[model samples]
Target: MSNEPDRAWWKEASVYQVYPRSFNDSDGDGIGDLQGIRNRVDYFDELGVDVVWLCPVYDSPNVDMGYDIRDYRSVMDEMGTMGDWEGLLDDVHDRGMKLVMDLVVNHTSDEHEWFQQSRDPDGEKDDWYIWREGDPDEPPNNWISLFGGPAWTYDEGREAWYLHLFDEKQPDLNWENPDVREAIYDMMNFWLEKGIDGFRMDAISCISKPHGLPDADTGEDWFDMDLYFNGPRIHEFMQEMAAETYENYDVMLIGETPGADPEEAKKYYDDGVDMVVHFDHMDVTYGPGGKWSPDYVGMETLASAGDDALDEMLNTMDLADLQEAIRYWDEGVGDEWNCLYMGSHDQTRAVSRFGDAHDYHRESATLVATFLLTQRATPFLYQGDEIGMTNADWDREDIRDVEARGQVDILMEEHDVPYETIAPFVRNRSRDNARTPMQWDDSEHAGFTDGDPWIQVNDDYERINAERAMADPDSIFHYYRRLLDLRSESEVLVYGDTEYVLPDETYPNVWAHRRTLGDEAVLVVLNWQDEPRDVSGVEGVESPVLFGNYEQRDGTTLQPYEARICDLG
Candidate 1:
């Protein structure tokens, strides 16, 4: 057994996300499994991530990775067996770490026994899933799926259209039924009884859809979500779920609701839920409008959201100013508007999305690491992010995300358009790029497993594997390790209050900030430019540099992608 503390130990520790498909694969059956994770337990223990937020590992049809659960009680056969999961859990506890699994109860697989029976023409479980009728002459409802299509899918055999907020394969559950809500809560107890420490709820608020099945030309872009996302009974259900598991066990629970209102979010935390993700975060680049502009926001739009809104946003941010708030999600959110960022099964890889290979990938990775590890909430580290992994090059033919691939096919076949025409847009939209295999060591399949992986590893894995990064002190791995150590040991960075220092008003690329505990403040600066610039922010520049990416001196010039941190009274 490892000498780590007990699972309760994570309150003071950091988490590392492990997306099964991309995490190391022990058996190499084209997917990552429990044994694959177990094989690297020692590495995790060494890196010192207190919790492992495993992406969905349940039995599923792989429609939305594991977000579309078929059997809440078991692991997918492709990933491993129930026994394998048990063993992995034991290993985690032995190392004094906790494991957080994805709780995808908002929807279930089309093949799930419940859904199958519900859709059966003459079955016992009818009405378990939301089944509706098509429009008199057009479609079912005006609601659009997150994957970009009608939320209702007609089942020919059943003569009814089932509701799916995501892929057609995932049918949303009807939480209005007492038995349904009870059963959902029962699943929480089931996992808790198994000694599971926590859950990352998937689309938990979508448990109930709009009461009335209103059709489109109805004027509203999305009638379902606006009407039901943080539904009337969502808080009630959350309270029941929390009372059953979270409140008593010191469990961490986070729900995934895209448009959840802040006031509504406070309900989850207030009802004894551990945390709720701050989704409005990704919306602040231009503020009010939520556009993703690389160039810093102009004063006009930035001012529109008001200084108060921006102040609260910057203060509650899970990462660096705007970018960290938008990027670096492995450090996910919790109750009380705490942010969660581990790339659950659905999101793209942090490295590829935020780090560019030709650009300051390593520097930016380190800067990002420093930013997230020392933030206000509990930070989560995604599986391969310790080594700064990048996304694999994608092709439409190589795409595997069900919704993305299906959409591409529909567009191509229906419109007779070239795949190349929408390839770039599709590439940005595909989830498969984030689902590739973990890059472990330089070997076949990057030492993930003996067999093929579910997704291909980034082609450059040969040079950017765990073994290589770990060997270099200046590497992303070492930098992350240092951050973990500092955050674990220092109160100022770990438990201190955060304040944002504006950029050198004149310079567009220089980002700076500070974290203060009592009178002591720690300043972090990043110069995202090719030519060196003046370090004019933060009045006092301590004599001895605390930590810097590039060498620093009085009136030091910052190089492109350079970052520096200073401690002051």
Candidate 2:
């Protein structure tokens, strides 16, 4: 609603997302905690990030790896006590950085006190969750949970069924209940009053559901996401929430919207959140079957792979579609805001997913960093991404993510999918890929923990650890540092209008874009191939190189996986 220029710290700041369980294990319990994060505040300071977003550390059963909240006010026992979290916040502030907590309000763990009381038919919190009287053998609707089975679970105690959009252990709360909304709002205020900066709202758009809970039109047994995502009262609830909490404090609010397009995202901003982390751009490589059937370079292609096949894999990504999505959000939101990120706790490693992580690791890593950092939106760097970390080579036995494991079971049981048929996709697209312990050094357990890591560390830690990166001037860590510095120093990079130069179909291996603010502009050219390519846009122009991955480059020729930023003043 406000088309004014954004001067807020969040708009200009770079966010570093740290998954606590995998970040670093300070207490050596094989799990990263608040103390671990506090111990590494200097690393964030050195990276020059303005904010650190810690994923859910709230009390949970770890059924869904912290997404299922048991207690909103208390920290997880494995993560540390509330005092440890407070100490971490103080350390981040002392290092001149802000900390944002992941707010998971979509559902609560079944073990939560509210849900426990709701289980009692005559209890005070009986209506706190969505409960319906239905046949004990049948669910109220044909809706399926996001994790895999029937959405409604029949509770023998109450002789009714409760709706759970995710895992059965995580029950969806009834937002229609005024007391529930008030409780959530009070929780928000509690964290705000505790000196935390803001919240990265988890699955926020899916909080509201249709009035009658009607069956989806998709004909499939599973609930259609469209039926519930950004429901009728979504904006009303968001506005009410903002009026109650966000409006009263100077803080940032970023909602994680799975199916939100630019227009829907604009609505979220209008309702008072700063921005929404939309997934359109990240899903460019998804095949017809979605994440389970991602279109990746085949083994045969890799065996006989030339520069062309490599280019085809990297360049064929619907970059043009990604650009359109970015432009749509920028134009649709006016001055609200948008988040630019290539990876997160739920997705695969960015360098491994988008860039050539094997052969041209450093070049591809910096290339992706350069492209993301120069964008108009606030850039988010996932932990371990700064040092070019890749996905862990895990077998089926090593899988830890509930969604991944559940999907595997569903595929095998329902779809007749063989282990070999689904394992490859799971290996490439599993959230566990990003959940591996942070590779801090080349020492045992990647220096993440003294004890055995909860998950296997990537074997390439010797070459990709942060310790080596910090010591090497030409490392990805330093490149990220320089990119962050550019954003800090140049106002154009922070608030510039984007202009895509080369279309994806025309120049499949090249992505060229210009960011301009008045007369000042920055041109970013990325060659996503494994072989040299000719760059043709800035011919005969006199623009000094602002940043580049490779050391030497002729004005027109680009090396393999090369990335360059030129100041077109």
Please list the C-alpha lDDT of all candidates, in the order they appear. 0.67, 0.84
Q: In candidate 2, what residue range of length 10 has the lowest lDDT sum?
A: 307-316
Candidate 2, residues 1-569: lDDT per residue as tens digits?
Answer: 22234577888999999999999899888999889988899999999999999999999999999999999999999999999999999999888899999999989999999999999989999999999997899788878887777889988888899999899999999999989999999999999999999999999988898989987776632458787588888889999999989797888799998778877888888888888998877777675456653235554453455543443353346667767766777776766788889899998988888887778889999999988898878899999889999876667889998889988887667646466655555656789989998999989989999998888888888878999999999899999998899899888888877777854565777788887787787888888878988766543223788888888887688889888888888
Where in model 1 is the C-alpha error above 4 Å? 1-11, 121-123, 134-137, 215-225, 281-337, 340-344, 407-417, 541-544, 551-555
Q: Which residue pairs in candidate 2 have backbone atoms (N, alpha carbon, C) closer than 3 angstroms, thus clashing?
A: none
Residue-wise C-alpha lDDT for candidate 1, range 1-569, written one tens digit per residue: 11232222444668787877668776657777788888888888888788888888899877777777889888888788999899999999999888888888888889888898888857767888888766534556567776767788888878888888788888888777777777878888888888988887777777755557565442524234565477667778777767766677877776666656655666766777565665544333223322212113333333355533432332222233564553233222222335545343455555444434445678767766765665656777777778877655567667878867766776566546576644543433356766677788899888877886666677888888998998888889888787788777766665555665545356566666666776666877766544577765445444345676555444556666677777775
Candidate 1: worst-modelled 10 consecutive residues by lDDT? 286-295
lDDT of 2 at 173: 94
